[model samples]
Target chain A: MPEQPDQSEQPDQSEQPDQSEQPDQSEQPNAAVEPGPGHRFAPDTEWRRVSPKYLVVEVIGSIITTAIIVAALLVAFSLWGLWWTPWAAGAVALIAVVAIAFEPRRVRSIGYRLREDDLLFRRGIMFQRQVAVPYGRMQLVDITRGPVARALGLADLKFVTAAAATAVTVPGIPEAEADRLRDELVALAESRRAGL
Target chain B: MSGAAPAKPAVDLADGEWHRLHPASPLLRGGLVFIAIAGFVIANLRERVVEFFLVIFAPGQLDDGFGEWSDENDWGRDPIGGIVANNLVGWALLAVLLVVVLVIVGFWLSWRMHTFRVTPEAVEVRSGILFRSHRSARLDRIQGINITRPVFARLFGAAKLEVQVAGQSGNMQLSYLGSSLTDGLRRDILRLASGARATTQSPAPAVALPSVAAGETLAEPLPGLAQPAGPAAAPGTGPATIGSRAGAIVGQRVDEFLAPELDPELAPPESVVHIPVGRIVGSTLLGGAALWMLALAGIVIVGVVSRQLWMLFTFVPAAIGIVSYFWSRITKSLRYSIAGTPDGVRVGYGLLSTANHTLPPGRIHAVEATQWVFWRPFGWWSVRINVAGQSVTSGAEAAQRTLVLPVGTAGDVQRVIALLLPEAAEGGPVAAQIGSGLTGRAGLDGDRFSITPKRGAWLHPFSWRRIGWAASDGIALLRRGSLVRRLVLVPLARMQSVALSAGPLRRGLGLAELRLHTVTGPVVPTLPIIEREAGDALFTHLAGEAVERANDDRSQHWGREAADA
Candidate 1:
C-alpha cells in the first residue's frame, strides 16, 4: 500500500508552507495557531497602505470605458442618426468623471496591524470597521497578488475562518509589508499551536 | 490526480458549449433575430413609410394629401412613394448586413479581450474592449476552483472554467479551453496551489481504494451497508460497501432519475415529473400531468394532421416529448457513487456526463443535509458541502448538469465529514458536563471553559445536530441555539491565535465573541466559531498545545521524504 503522505502523522508537514520574504508563494502565508486571546496582532505595527496605483488603474479603466462608450455612441449615431437626444454622452461622461475623482481613497482605505498575537484589519475609511482575528483562530494566513496588485507592488492578506464568513480580507498594502505580516502571523499561529 | 501522470498535473474539466440558440450565436440565428426585429420595425413603420413616400411624390409639402394617402394604405403610395419605400427596405437591408458584420466582429473581439493565462505562480485574466482590465491572482490565493461541464458545452467540447480565488472576483469567466485542457489546467493549478507535488516521485501509481475489502472490482452499486465493524464508529455512521455491478446499476439509476432534476429549473416536456406512483402526491402528480398532457397533445396532433397532408417536423410536441423521455431515462440511471478511505473520498455521479470528485480528510469546511416536503414520501435527501474555497454553484449551463451528491445515504454523512474534517467528526466526554449545564464551565474535558447562559441548554437539542465550531488553538466544542446550533472543534494548535470583540448589544450584555482563523490545502479553509467568553477560554486551554509544534520550523521537513525535502 502506498503511503498517503500523512499530514496529520507529522503535524509538522502542515506547518512548512509559510516561509517567504519575497517569495510570492501563490497566496498569503497562512500557518495554524492555537486558540487564545494571545494571538492578537502587534499593537505598534501600522499598515502603510500602498497608494493603490491599482485603484488609479480602476479609475483609468473607467475613463477608458467612458471613452469607449463615447466612441461607440459616435459610431452608433453616425449609423442610427440621433433624433431625440444629443447631449446624452456628455451627461454620462460628466457623471463618470465625478465618481472617479474622489472614490478611490475611500475605496481602498484598508488598514492592518500585526500586533504581537492578533491580526487587526480596519477598512472602509468612512464606514471603518475594525476586525481583529487572533493568530490562533486565524485558520490560514494567505498572501495573494494579481497582475494589478503586482503592478502596484501590493498584496492582499486574507484571514480565513470556519465561521459562516471564513474569509476576512485586507487589501492594498506594500508587498514587503504583506510578506512580513504573513510570516509574523503564521509564526504566531504556529506558536499558539505549539503551546497546546 | 495522484497517479494519472507525473510531469503534468490534473486540471479542471471544462463545461462544453452548445450550438448557438441565443440571438447572438451563429450567423443563421443572428440573421433570424435581425429579421424578427426588422419585421416588427417594418410593421410599425408602414403608415409612416407611405406618407414619406407620398411626400417624395408630391414634393410641395402636401401634408394633408400625404395624410390622406397614408389613410388609404399604410405601406403603398402612388409611384413616388412606392419607390421611396422600396429604397427604404434596400437601405435597411444593407444596414442590417453591416450590423450583422459588426456584431460578429465584436463577439470575436470580446472573446479575445477576455482571454486568460495560467502559469505556475499566478493566473492572469485580461479583459476589455477599450479600457484595459488585467486581473491576476497567485495560485495559492485561489480559495477554491469549481469545474463544470454542461450538456450544451458537452456537445461543443467547450467547457467553462470558473476559478474562485479569494478577494473579489469580477464575474465567472468562460475559459477558452475545452474538456482535456480544462481538466489538465485544473489539476495543475490545484497541485501547485495546494503545495502538493505537481510531479509525483513514484514511478508506479497508488492503487485505487475501495469502500470495501480489497480485491473488489469497482463495477457497480455498493451492495449492502458495511456491518458496523467497530465500536468507536458513531451509530448509523457505518461504511456501505457496494459491489461493482450494483454500483454501476445504482449509478446509472441516479443518472437517469436524479441527473435531469439536478437542473430543477428546467421544465421537462409536458411539464410532467414522472415518479413512482406509490410515492407522494408530488410524484403522483407528475404521472397524472404527463398522461393528461399526452392526451391533449394527441388531440392537437389529430387536428394538425387534418390541416393539409401530414407535416412531419411540425410535430414539435412529439419531438419535445421524445427528448424529455431521454432526459428522464438518463436521470433514473444516475446515482451518487462514493467510497471512503481514511485518506480521502471519491464521489462520482451522472451517466454520459459524469463528474468524479476527490477530497482528502482535513479539507472539508462544512457539510449539511436537507429535505424538502416533496421528499417526505420518496425517502430521499440532498447533501451539501461547503469546502472553504469551492462553491458548487455552477454557471447557467453546467449548473443544470453538475452532481450535487457526493454520497448517498444519511449514514455516510458523518464518516464523510470525518473524511473531510477530522476535528468535527469526533464526539467527546464533555457532553455530560454541558448537559448538566455547567454554568461557567461549559466543556467537560477541562480543555476549555465557557459560561452556560440560558442558551447552553439548546446546544444539543436532538442527538448531535449543530453548527460545529473549532477554535484555532483551543478546545473544540459543539453549540446550538433555539434558532441555531454551532458545533466547534478546536484543535489545540488553533487556540494560539484568539481574538475577542463585542458589538454594541453584546458588549452591554458582557458578552464578547472570539474569532479563530486558519487556512490550508487546495481547500485551504478556515474555521471560526463564536462562543460566550468562558466557552472560548476552555477551548483555548484544550487545543493550545497542538499549535506549538505547528509553529516550529524544524518539523517542516518531516513529511516530504518523497518530494523535494
Candidate 2:
C-alpha cells in the first residue's frame, strides 16, 4: 500500500468534511484493488470496485478486434499486393499490445457507490466521469452478459434514465452480485418512481 | 342548406360529433402526385397531340416526310408514344381518362371515410379506406396543439391541426381543415383538455357517445366556408355580378396572403411581441451569411496568393447557397410573434405559409437563451426550448418549430421566460439573474453565481470568467461561452440526472465539471471547472432536490382542478 502521509498535505476548509479522519478502506490488502495514482475526490464515501478478472475480459476483446483488423489487411494484401498493408498491420498490433498492457489499471479505475438517494458511478483514468443517477429517475435497470463474460461468471449492470444522454453502465461485476444489484435497484426505482 | 348561412350559430366542435375534414383536403394532399403524373403523360404524348392538331388544321399539307423522319429518328420508345405510333391513340386516351376517373373516385372515397371526433375525454381520428386506422389522444396527456398552413393549402384556405402527445408516434393529425374553423376548433380542444366543461346549455355526457345527428349539421358549414365563391355568386344577386364576384375572390385571396398572422381573440393585440423585419434581416446577415462571406474572402485571398484564377469559380455555388439560405431565413421569420394566452404560450411565424403552435403550461422541459457574438452589440438573444413530442432534428423547419423566440431583446427574453416558466421567473429576480448571466463578468458578481475558480483559467482560457451555475427557487441556471453566450434554465423537477466529471488536467487542479441531464435538445447544461468539493455538494443537493421536486410535481395534469388549486 502507498503511504498515508499525503492526506495531511490537503488544506482544511470549514465547510468540507475532513476526509483524513475516516479510515481508508481502499488501502486495505483484502479490499478491492484501487487503480491509478489519481486522488479520490470524496474519500469518505465508500466506493465498490469491480472484479480483477475483468482485465482478462478486456484483453481478450482487444485481441479479437486486433486479429480481425490484421486478418482483413492480410487478405487485401494477398489479393492486391498492397504496399501499405504490412505497415498498417504492424501499427495496429502495436496499439493492441499497449492497450492489453494497461487493461489491469483500467479495470481497477471502475467503481460505484450507493448513496441514500442515488447511485454514484466512477470510471476512466485520463478522463474520469462520475455520474449520480437518482433512484427515482431510473426507468430501467438491466443486466447483460457477453459470451466470454458469461464463461467467466461476470455480468454488466446498466441504468437507463428518461434522457438518452444519461447512459451509465457498470461492467464486469460477478453474476450473483450483478443480479442482486439489479433487484435492489429495481425495487428502489419502483418505490421512488418519477415521471419525465 | 339554409343552416350553412354565414351567420350560423357558433359550433361547439368538442360535442363528441364526428366531423369530416374540409373538401379541399384530398386535392391538397394528392395534388403533387396528380401533377407529376400529368407532366409525365404530357411529356410522353406531346408529339401525338401536336400531330392530331395538325391533321385537324391542315389535312391537305400532310406529307410522307413526317413518317420518314419519325422512322429515321426511332423516337417511339416510350410506352405512351409507342401506343400512339401504333394507331392506338383513341384507346390510350380512353385508358388515361379511366385512370383519372379512378383516382378522383379513390380520393373522394378516402375523404368521405376520413373523420375526427373530439370528446371531453379524448380526441380521436379515424382514416383510410382499405386499411382503416384509429388514433386517440387523452385530454390529460396532450403536450401542445399546432396549426400549420402550407403555401398551397393556404391558398385553398385549409390548415392542418396536430394534437401533440408525450410519446413517439403519439401525435394525431387532422389535415386540411377549413382555416377559419381551425382556431376555434383548437380552442375548444384545449378547453376540453383543460378539464373545463363545454360552454353550451347542455353539458356533454360523461360517457362518450357518437351523436350523428349533431354531426350532420356540422358538415354543411365546411363546404360553405371552403368555397367563398359559392355565396358571392349566389343566383339572381344584383350587386354581385359574375365579373365583380371573380374580382372580389381575387382581392380576398390577396388579403389572406398579406394579412398579419395573429388571432385577436386568442391573444390580446397589445400582448403579442412582433419581431421587426429589419431585425430579422440584420440578424440573418450577421449570422451564417457573414461566415460564408468570410469563407469566400479566404478562398479569394488564397487564389490570389497562389495565382490560380480558376479557384474563383468555386465561389459561384457557395454564393448562391448563402443567398438562398439568407432569403429562406428571412421569409421563415418574417412575422414572428409570441404571446401568452389563457391556455398556454402561443407562438406564430412565417409570412405566406403561417404556422402557429400553443404550448400548454408545464410542457416545456428546458429553455435556453443564447446570443451569438455578432448579435451581442445589438443585445439580440434567441430562445429555444425542449418540448416533448416535438421533432428535434436539425433543419430549417425543426429549428423554427423549436425556437420560441427567433430574435429578441433582453426584455423580450425575460418576458418569454416568464411566460414559459412562471415558477422560475417569479418575484422578478430571474430578469436580473439572466442579465448577469448574459454579460456579467464572474469575479464582479461572485455572490450571485458560483463561478469557476481563477486557477481553472487554463482549461477555458478566454471563457473561464463566464462559466458558472446558479440555482434559484426550483430552477438551475447554467451560463457558459464567451463568443456565443448561452444561459440554460432547467426546472429541478425536469432534471433526468446529475453528473460530475474530471479530466486529468482538472483532476490535478482539484476541479470537476457538473452537468444536469435533460431531454436531448440544443441546450446542454454543463458548468465546467469548479471546485471538487463544491461539485460533490452540488451533486448531492441536486439529486435530492430533483427527487423531492419530482415527487411534488403535478405538472402532467396541469389543467386539472387539483393542479390549479
Candidate 3:
C-alpha cells in the first residue's frame, strides 16, 4: 500500500518537461524529442526508451516459457503419476500471468542516455540502478538478437569493461538503432581505450 | 661496486634467441611420474624382467640353473626370488640400467623439443611434441611475474616462472628454469614490458648466487653441450674439486633453507614489516579456527546433554580437518615477507617450498585493508589487492596469492599502501587519511571524509559511523563496516565504471550505494548508504575523473622516462 503513493507520484514528475536544457537540444542527437515519461532521478538528461514492440516480445517470451513448464509438468504427471504436477503448473502459469501484466511498465522503465564522457544506463522502477560506463573504459560493445527479437526487428546492446561486475546491457533497442549505437561505442572506445 | 665507477652491466638473458628450458624440465614437468612408475615396475617385477632377458641371452644356463631351484622353491608361485635363486642378479641390474638409459634419452628428447623465445615485443613459448601448441604473452600487456619453487624442484635448484598477462588463459609458464636465472629473467622482462630501451637499462645489481649453487653446478656441464654457457654460471668454479664441490653445495642448500626468505640482492635487505610468528599463529586461530572450534564445542555440549555417545565418533575427522587447516595457515605464513624491489613490490612466502611474486608499478587495480572484529583487539589488518590477470584462479589459491599483507598492524598497512601507490603517497595526506580510515569512528566533519549522515543510521545502525568516502589526488577511499572494518582504495585511473543504486528501503531513507567498479578480485569497492545528494555528486565526479585520470596516466610505462624529461 505504501508503494502505491510512490508509484502514483512518478507519473506527475515524468510529465514535467526539463526546463533548463531547452536551447542545448542541438548537442544531444539521441535526446528524446517528445516529453515522454522521464526518469525521476535524472530529469535533466534525456533518456531514450526501448521500442514499444518490446512489450509484445516480453509477453510472447513469458508465454513460451510458461507453456514449456506446463508441458514438462503434464508429461511428468502422465508418466510418473505425480499428483503435485497440476498445482506446480498452476503456480507457474500465475507467475507468468503477473510477469506478462507488468511487461509494458518494465520495458518503459529501461532507458539509456549518452553524456559528454560516458554512457549512462538506467533500469528498474522501485529498485532503480543507474550506471555510468566511461567511453574510455569500454573494452567491447556487442549487439545480440534472439529469434523473437529478430522477428520483431529488435536487438540488445551490451557493454563490456575490464570489470566483470559492470554488467551493462541495454535490451529491446530497434535493430538499426542497436547497430548505430554499437558502431558509435566501438569508435569511442577505440579513441579512448584505457588499459586495465 | 663503488658508486663512482661504471658498474658492470649484468648480462641480459632475454637477448632475442630461442632457448631450451633447464635440462631437468622434463622430469619436473610430469616425467617424474613416469620415472616413479618405471621404478615401481622394476622393483616389483625384477625376477620376470631378468628371466625374460636370460631367456634371450642364456637360455641353456637358465634351464639348467632354474630347473633344480624351481622345484625346491615352487618358483612358479614365488618368481620374486628368481634373480637370486637362478644367479641372474647381474642380468637384472643390466636390464634396470637399460630402462633408465631409455627413459633418460626420451626425457632428453622431450626437453629438446620444448623451446621458448624472448623478443622485444613478446615472450613466446612453444611446447608439446605432437600437439605443438604455442603461447605468447606480449610485453606491453604483462601484468606481473611470479617465481615459484616447489620443494622437489627446489632440491634441483629449478623454479617455475609464470608471465601474467591481462586475460584468462594469458599466462605463459616456463616450468623448470634454473632458480639463479629466474630473478634476473623476471627483472629483464619487467623492464622490457615497462617500455624501457635495452640501451637505457640500468646496471643490474650483483645478484649473489649462493642459494642456487647446487642448481648452477648441476646445470653447468649441460649448458656447455647445448650452447655456449650463457652468464648462468657463477665466476671461477671448475669440475676439478668435484668431491669438495658436492659437499659445499649441500652446506649452501642447508644455509639457504635456514636463511631469511628475502634475497638482499633482489629486494631490500630487510622487509618493510616483520610479522612475528606468534602473531601469524594468533591471527590464523582468531580468523576462522576459533569459530569452527566454538561450533565443535557446541556440538559436543549438545551431544553430552542428550547422552548421545555415538556423536563423539563423528567428531574425530572434523577435529583433524580443523587442525590441518591451522597447520597449513601457519606454514604458509611462516616466512611471509613483502619488500620493494626496483621491478616492483616483491611478496615472498612459504617455509620449504617458496613463492615470490613481483607486482610492477601500476599493476595493482585496487587495494583493500580490512580488520576482523577478533583482530581489532590486536590492531591487526590484512591487505588484499586486485591485479588484472590474477582473477583467473579461484578459491584458496586466489585468496592466498591476492593477499599482499596477510596480517599486519596499522603502521604496516600504511607502509604497504605507500609501496603500492607511490603516486598517492607523495605528499603524505593519503597515508594520513588512510590511517584515520583504518581506525577512525564516524563524525560529521566537512573535511577529510564525507561520512554517512546520522539519519542514515537506520540502514547501517552498527556501521553508520564508520561508513564514509573520500577522494583526493586521483584516488578514492571507501570505508565501511564496523564489525569487519574495511577500507577500499581505487586509483581513479583504474576505475572501469561508476554505478549508483537505491533499493526500496534506501530510497525511502534518501540514500544510495555507490560502487567503483574495478577488475574482479577480493576487493569490493562499494560505498553503501551515503546521502543521495552525495551519491549523485560522486557519480558525476568519479565518471569525469576516471576518464581524465586514465588519459593522464603514465603508470603503464612506468620505467620509461617522462615525456617532459
- Give per-residue lDDT, candidate 3, residue B127: 80
Estimate, for each residue in B1-565, the C-alpha lDDT of model 1 and write its tens digit.
2232332322222111111121222323234465688689668767766666556576676566433333335444353344443456467547768987887786666655555655545677676698888777765445444444445444444445566553323334544354434444454455444434334423212311111111122112222222222223434333323333344444443333333322221111221122222332233233324565566567667767787325544565776765575455344325434444322344544445544344433333334333333343443333444443433444422332222342233333334444434443446343332222111123444434333343323333332222233333123443333222223333433333344444544444444444443322121122222344563453344333434433442211211332454
Please give the TM-score for the first chain of candidate 1. 0.57
Give the per-residue lDDT of model 2 (tens digit) for B1-565.
3343323433445667888899989989886679888899778768766765565478777655245434424654545435535667678669979988999999999999999998767999999999999888987678889999899988887889989887756888899897767777887787666653433214333111122222333443434454465445664576446545455555545555665566765576564466888999999889847987888889999999999989988688987888898888888888787888878888888877899889877778889999999999999999999876655664566567788888889888888898898775646666567777777768883346777888878888988888888877778888888888898888888898888888888999999989888877677788877899998888777876776677667565455543345
- Give the higher-TM-score candidate: 1 or 3: 3
lDDT per residue (tens digit) for residues A45-149 in model 2: 368999988888898899999999999998999999999998999999999998888778888999998654578898988788888787767888889999999
Give one digit per residue, the lDDT tens place, for model 1 in A49-135.
Answer: 545565754676678888988787777778898852347777778888887876676556655655434555655543334455556
**Candidate 3 residue-wise lDDT at A162:** 90
**Candidate 3 per-residue lDDT over residues B296-398, each given as its tens digit:** 9899999899999799779989999999899888888888889988678989999988888889888888999999999999999999999887664566766
True contacts kept of each: 0.18, 0.71, 0.78
lDDT of 1 at B32: 48
Off by over 4 Å in 2: A1-55, A67-105, A113-116, A173-191, B1-13, B36-48, B56-66, B69-81, B119-122, B167-170, B195-260, B297-315, B390-394, B445-447, B561-564
Q: How does model 3 fare in lDDT?
A: 0.78
Better of 1 and 2 by DockQ: 2
Indicate the residue-level lDDT of B90 in model 2: 77
